[model samples]
Target: MKSIRKYMNLPGSLFLVTLIFAMSMTPVSASAAALRADIVQCDPNPAEIGQYVNVWIKIENIGNTRAEDVSVELIPSYPFSLDTGDDTVRNIGILSTDRHASLEYNLHVDENARPGTRSIKVRYQDDEGTAWNEETLNIWVGSGSDTFDSKGTIQLEQITIEPEVLMPGDTGTVTFTLKNTATQYSISLGGEEYDTNARIRSATLEGTDDITVKSDPYHDTGILGPGDNVELTYNIEVDDTARDGTKHLEFIVVGSSYTYNYKWDVPVKVDSAGIKVIPTKPLTIDNGVATIQFDIVNTNPNTLTSVSIRPQAEGIEFSPVEYFIGSMEPDELFTAEFDAQVVSDNISNQQELALIAQYRNGINQHETFLNDLSLTIVTEKPNSGTGLASISILLIIFVISSLVMYRHKKHQQ
Candidate 1:
């Protein structure tokens, strides 16, 4: 997980940072929800006490008065507790005014608490004795519980890797988790433990102090009894040694093929982790047609296959909304040509050439919007390929005839 940047606010300076970008280093400049305090939003309005939940909030002028302290506390004996901004539950504060803040936290409900009607509150109050605003969440819990933490078969259930996308050589960690999938209690990592799409850059067990990880996909896997959990955490080094673009890991659990594939995109960038869209200015023409050539450079460091492009109306006419840029290697340059017809009568216009890049990420694949596309106008008359071919044929015929006649006259003389 990327470290969520935390800073104590000192009265009224704009305390805006990553909001929607999920731990992004900078704040997006424009937003409607960024300027107000109805900031943080949570999902599963009325949640069950023991269920995992996600809370999403948008903020503006959070610590408007003095980077006032803010904390989302789960009432006593609550199932799960989680919060962004502040790592621990103590006196906490974030930026207040003129800043847009977006934060999300993943928390789970505890299984031991007595069941009944309860409420969870996300409270925001100034550090000093002052007014406060709060959002109350209702949750329902079961009565005297006899439920045990998932004690199912120790099936090597799932592995979630952070930084779903990355450039080659960018390092991240791959965590292997064993869920009590079956009705068993404990599982072990003593058997064939492997990442189908991952190459171990470095790995260390949970308690180890070393950086280099020795991974044995097979020889010593573990055991998972029903409803128990175990994890083997490994450090991943995107093969700085391979081509750029997306590279995925493939794995088989036990013996049956687990249909999940893990991969990452090798971006054109050498230092960044995700891909950036270098949008091109759309095709410009003076009259009715424009031919524009645009290029895409994978910003990731892994090799990418079947990278897709979606065209956002570039103020010009386009046929298919999506175009496929087949098989791009990391840092490889690929071209896409678009010829938009500009009806001479309606010229001045604004449109976008939008693209969404979809390829295989490490595990389950996902899609990222290149969102950046070239915008262009039509000012020139486009040459018709068919018409050009016909003109060339006629000119060729005329020249051939003239040459034949000259040769015949010379022979007769």
Candidate 2:
């Protein structure tokens, strides 16, 4: 009976040992929670100075237990400020194991922020105020070296000119359109849309020596809201001495905070108020007859009225002494022809043909005359058929005269 009791006691002892081992293996809930925080994304990466940036922070419960009443806070460093007026601490109700929660915040970078990578600190804790995790988010700020600010707040949209083509000594207007291209959006921290002003405090025009600003060169444009545009007009005068070429003009947009310089070329053309006379065919004299042909070109921008030409030559007679051209527009070409007979015995090989052109300049209908225009006349040999015919007629006239003389002599004898 004693041996049987010992075996039973051994079995009970083994059972207790097994029970204790199973209990030890079971997991027990702990008072503290295991949390991990990471900054996953930053919108408008490489943020611009003096601009707002959105940062997204992610929190995950890596441990087996759940995190209760979690809160997140942002600690800004130098050149980085909290734009969102709300408290830094954000309340997150609960987080389960292997689960994550995201929080967003808006931060502003100072205008004088140095370029390069910077850091901001984020702290998270539980309801009991026990510290959970602290992490750093790296941010990059622009150096503001580009023409446009990093935020793209202000831009030069379009430039227009009155009388697209410019002439010497002409006065015109130049219009510049400045637009506020900044985008407005609601901030999670502030619970309102961001507000910023795009102000073009002043503007000036710069050009070469040929171009001058007639009126006030400077202008003041008040503050502009998002998507708002303002037009700045300037009166400019082109010098009379300006050549017929392209000239560069600079439009400078100046603000109390920034400056932008833009350049454009203006084309200048010659005035069209003159005429050009050119010879189309050479003047020739054959068999005591002169043929003259020439062209008259209207070079003026305006139309010429009552155009007439008078041809005069010493020791010469012309079939049509004058020619009347009704009207001639700009760049129009009119041809004039004349036939003249030589009347003088002594004639030089080259003869001068005098021509006087009269026309209305279109300003007041006043007749303007271009006089004493001379042309050289060259002597040319007659064609074979005409030369032979003239020689036969001369011979016939001489023979008839000789026969008449012979008959008269015989009668006298």
Candidate 3:
């Protein structure tokens, strides 16, 4: 009895042990908050002394959980001070995981500040009453004694649009060649010598409702010396329902800062024309089969490649499943022929056939649909000439037999 009681308690002990083990293995959520601060923008970068400068700092939370009671503080040191009547600390209620917040601060540069790079302190707190995390960010201060200045001008030297012309629902690339048109490395402006190197801070292609830009904006394009050029390409797509004619996109190139920016209207031509399939002969199926012919015309202003046509209709069979036309030039025409037959008797007297035209504009594949076409199915009719000929033959044979009987009777008499 003692051994049996011990065995019975062993099962309960194992179950209790398992319960404790499971409780220990269960995961617990941790309270972790990772935050980072960076200075995103400085108005009039290379800010001049004796003036107020606007600074923008971005704080991001890159942790698994939300950062509660987020706040940021700006600490200005020598050569920089907070603008009069401005607070140093900003309150940002909460920042979720992978989310960010932007803070703007106004600072006054001391009149005696020298032309050089200076560091400023920024502190952020994720939780209330928690230790503040600090970061040092640098800003450039410019003065008359600056060694280099962006004295050159940037121009759009060339614009290349792939396929030359775009059709509705097509995607292509627009490449821009930006050039610093200055002649010498240094130039004199108002008795001041400045370097002619042009720095492309950012380049972006703006799109409208009809066109969509698929490429990201280009930033920090480096320095382009006098007469140097760089090519930047952007992928764009045209809306399927876009109207015909020329569409303009605004291409902006910023040099050095916001004050030195170039904006140009880049025009792209959109032609809504495509392959047109028209029946050249009567669309009639006589005696269960017929030959159908269609004229494939390239109505587009540009050449199209890999041209092919396929006809489809319910309860109707088409031979040579698809007709292939290698390439077509502008306004070119080609005739395609197909043998069609009625495979189902339930089809109506006339059946609608879809002529799907597939082609490629440059490297982009396109499809044109022609659904208004129809095929007339004509049933076979019996011939009346066969019975008329049989009656004629019978009459001739009767006349011959009568003549033979008359001759035999005459001989017997």
Best by TM-score: 3
Tens-digit lDDT track for model 3 on 1-413? Answer: 99999998998999999998877664222237788887656665667788878887878876777888998989999799986678888899888775677788888889999888898999988878877889999987878553236878898999999988999889999999999999998978799988888888768787766787789878788999999999999999998888999999888776764467677999999998889988999999987899999999999998999999999999989988999998999999999999998889799888999999999997889987889988888897899999999999999999999999999999999
* TM-score (all chains, Cα) for each model: 0.31, 0.33, 0.63
The count of backbone overlaps in candidate 1 is: 97
Q: Give me candidate 2's TM-score against the actual structure.
A: 0.33
Tell me the TM-score of model 3. 0.63
Model 2 per-residue lDDT tens digits across residues 144-206? 552233222567787776634455666767787878776662122345444455655346665
Descending-TM-score candidate ranking: 3, 2, 1
Hey, what RMSD does candidate 3 come out at? 8.4
lDDT of 2 at 156: 73
Tell me the RMSD of model 2 versus the true structure.
30.5
lDDT of 3: 0.86
Per-model RMSD to reference = 19.5, 30.5, 8.4
Q: After aligning candidate 1 to the native by TM-score, how far in Å is the CA of 372 from where it should be?
A: 8.1
Which 10-residue window in model 1 sums to the lowest lDDT? 201-210
